[model samples]
Target: MGRSREKEDAESRFNSPVSISVADSSVSLLKLISILIIFVVGVVIGLVSSSHIDRYFSFRADQFNIKNIYFAADQFSSDSEKMLVNCERECALSMESFIRPLNLNHRMTDDELFWRASMVPQKEEFPFKRVPKVAFMFMTRGPLPMMPLWDRFFSGQDVDKYSIYVHALPGFELNVSNSSVFYRRQIPSQHVEWGSVSLVDGEKRLLANALLDFSNERFVLLSESCIPIYNFQTVYKYLTRSVHSFVESYDNPSRYGRGRYNRRMKPDIRLTDWRKGSQWFEIHRTLAIKIVADTKYYKLFKKYCHPSCYPDEHYIPTYLHKFYGALNANRTVTYVDWSLMGPHPATFTAVNITEGFLQSLRNNGTLCSYNTEKTSVCYLFARKFDSSALEPLLNISSQVLGF
Candidate 1:
């Protein structure tokens, strides 16, 4: 009891002095809190030094300029809009191309189709991005007697470079299988006779049919008897690159020329302006359009030209000679042995199917002005071949025609 009372008295003397160890610990605690405060302030200053660009604005802290943030936005939007428009345009063109071949089987819209087939842009303008093609148009009376020869000629060629059209006599059935080059190529045709307006009409129909395809750049008129003298490539190069059309045009003072002219065609087609040319012709797209577009002269020929007048002989020559004389080569690419015939040219039989005769036709000794001046290599096709020449032509096709 005495010891416990002595300890309580000592503690009551706490007011006199504090312990050294307790005082030192309190001072250490104060120093630690001061260091923490400095570190927190330093961190805040570092973050503020790396702030967003919005801080640079002078007037207000929250306000920012859109012109600075969206500088490239307008440009990006314009480019995206252009891309979208281009894609839409291209899609529309592709759709139209898919629908064109289907239109051929529909009813004849000959009058509404005239302007489309015949109207063309100026000489300097060409809008077809597609590769240009050659349209081989055959104005046959009926079945093609020399189709085998033609099949071989057209075989194994690039499908993109050429197209075929046959204006056969209505109801004339051909044995052409679906695999043939001429398969299903027959257009809606009417009856045609020699030396008549119907012949011209037939050729016009071919032009209109071929013109439906915008890619066709050159149009060739062929009869069933006609055979290509050169390979497709040679003929293609000769015609496709030709600046002037190859229609045998000349000033025929003979009874066949101006003699066939109707004086009623005075202001439209004067006798002096009248001309003569072969019916078989190779014309460019421009001339082909002009032919189809010719209501005035075609009317004149239909009214005036007779079998003796021979519209087939004088109509094309006179019209082309009037407007586009200088552009005409004044020659034909098709070879006809007119030396042996009356009104019609001589037809070739198996006897004339020798390699030497064909080679001579290809390299005739005569020179005619082609795309440029006269060249040694002239004829690309020949006409008036009989059906019997088919076998011989096929036999020598590989060795001679180079198909």
Candidate 2:
């Protein structure tokens, strides 16, 4: 009986439920701790990853708010290396603070700036809000003597519809008040001798500077002496809706025409290819870019054509005739009287600025094709007005000129 009791006790100790429950509780506690540790680590990792993701998207949104981007490639020279650098830098900045105005204030050379401006996109459609603006490029000798007249013309017009660029003699500053429209609008200019290639260079420089702004759709070459004969609204509509660019291109076989052709311009520019036009031209943006990008023909003309050849009158007319004849209106939008038939046209003085004379100029009765329809109203601007004519122009501006 004693031996049977000993064996039963030993079996009972091995199969006790209390001992098994204690061991199971310890293992369950270990598993719970492990699971909680793993979940906490996962939560920490998720928080870090989500924070980084938010920052990345926020940075992108801030950087790329710009509506349009014009990436001028790095093919330009070292002097213009700032163009690409500035583009890259500006990408990091807010869209409101974009490219700096590339005008007289900038120190870039004409060659470098022209090369930089020539890098236009091949695509036709713009990716931004494009309000087409006319760029009035004034190639002047010094101060604009007729500032009051221009102020009247530009007054009460939409500021966004137009831009101004002045190419005055180097070191010349416009002597206008702070409220003047022409205040601080000059571009970097070189000395332009009359009837020389330098005159054409000034025009190209103005174009290059203006091209920096992509919104300028039309380019008008004017002088300090030039004045708008019509109101700003009329001029704006006339240019923006025109089917073709107004560039007076004609064949003058006389001494002034064929006599300017240089034989050295043979293979690229032929004698038959020679053309003549007024320096004051109104062209579309496409032609403006073409003029700035032209190196081959420009070099030929600059080297060979000078003195009596007058690159300002020939280079653009001949170049466009050869390449873009179909797009040209083949007429000038500026009026000048060559009735005296002198080397220079007639200059209108204060005495000449009359209501009758101005009306006669407006209605010259010469029928020309406007938008493929015959119209008598041809000129938009006139030049060679003396400083003394400003008062008369201002007095009759509202009634006669409708400014």
Candidate 3:
């Protein structure tokens, strides 16, 4: 009976739908707790990783925005620089066109020319580097026959120390090489008649042109017939060092002096104020500017001083005596022989260009003050040399003249 009852209990227990023991229940609870903990840990890790990823993408986006901004600024700056370059180029072209014209034939009137030349710097010192230069102004009727001799005289000299200006007849061009010093040195010219107001006009025109160059501190007037009696260095040193201008001015009672004075120049000019001089002159820049700026005196001479009056001979002398007498040395550096007793000076020919004759002229038995000391070296240049004398002069230029 006992065995049968135990078997029934076991069967009933098996049939009673999976009744669990205490140990089994404990194992199931532990597995459930572990699964819940693992799920919570996974959720927290996902939240933290997602936040880190978002921050990394945000930083990269900011870096890309900054690069785009810098690129745009660089493009704008490049465009601005190009525009500035174009503007500067255009301004430079405009300025160049205004300052320098294409043609050499400047057709400006004398009134305009003088007005332009008279414009001087008001300051005591010049704005630019000022190396004083001597201006040799040549007023010629036609082509220069003595250019070869002059070329030799000027060769190998410092170009900056001297300047050349030629005022030939209108429409005339000097046929010189580009390498020649006189090349392209011709200023605009007018028709100049001998012994007329036009002659004075031509001289003033040369002065006005020379005055345009601020570096020209001394001005010497010359003609095609004129020749330097000494070497260039000697002439330059003598002229530049002298305190007084070498303008041959003197008061004479003869008809050539006071007789040439016209009463029509009444209060402005008088016989007592009249004087005579050689036309060739070497004046300082101060006197040069004064000559160019003169209007009243020039007009009076133009109207009254005719052929017999000889404006070239009397006007500048009278003008200087009346105004700037102290500035002149009262003599000429250029030697002219009036011993032949004619209306004009003696015309030297080839035969006259001897070594002895030149030597006499150089030490012409006359005493004149040079830089306040009396000296026998009176003459620096001689004039009215015939074109035929050029060869003889050239022959003696090196040895006797020491040029």
User: Which candidate leads in TM-score?
Assistant: 2
How good is model 1 by TM-score?
A: 0.73
Task: Output the lDDT of residue 92, model 2.
Answer: 51
Clash statistics: count for each candidate = 0, 0, 0
lDDT of 2 by residue, 1-403 (tens): 9999999998889778788999999999999999999999999999999999999998886666532232333343354455546745765564432323532467688889998778777797876677899999888888888888888889878888999999889788777787888977877678989999998888899999988888888999998888898899999999999989999999999889988899999899998899999999999989999999989999999899977788988999999999999999999999988888999999999999889989888897889999899998899999889898888888998899998
Candidate 1, residues 144-164, lDDT tens digits: the string is 988877777778888778989
Candidate 2: where are CA atoms >4 Å away?
1-104
Candidate 3 ranges beyond 4 A from true positions: 1-105
Q: After superposition, how far is residue 262 of candidate 2 from its true place, in Å?
A: 1.1
Predictions in order: lDDT = 0.80, 0.86, 0.85
- Model 1 stretches astray by more than 4 angstroms: 1-94, 98-103, 121-128
Query: What TM-score does structure 2 among the candidates reach?
Result: 0.76
Instruction: List the candidates' TM-scores in order.
Output: 0.73, 0.76, 0.74
What ranking of all candidate models by lDDT puts the best one first? 2, 3, 1
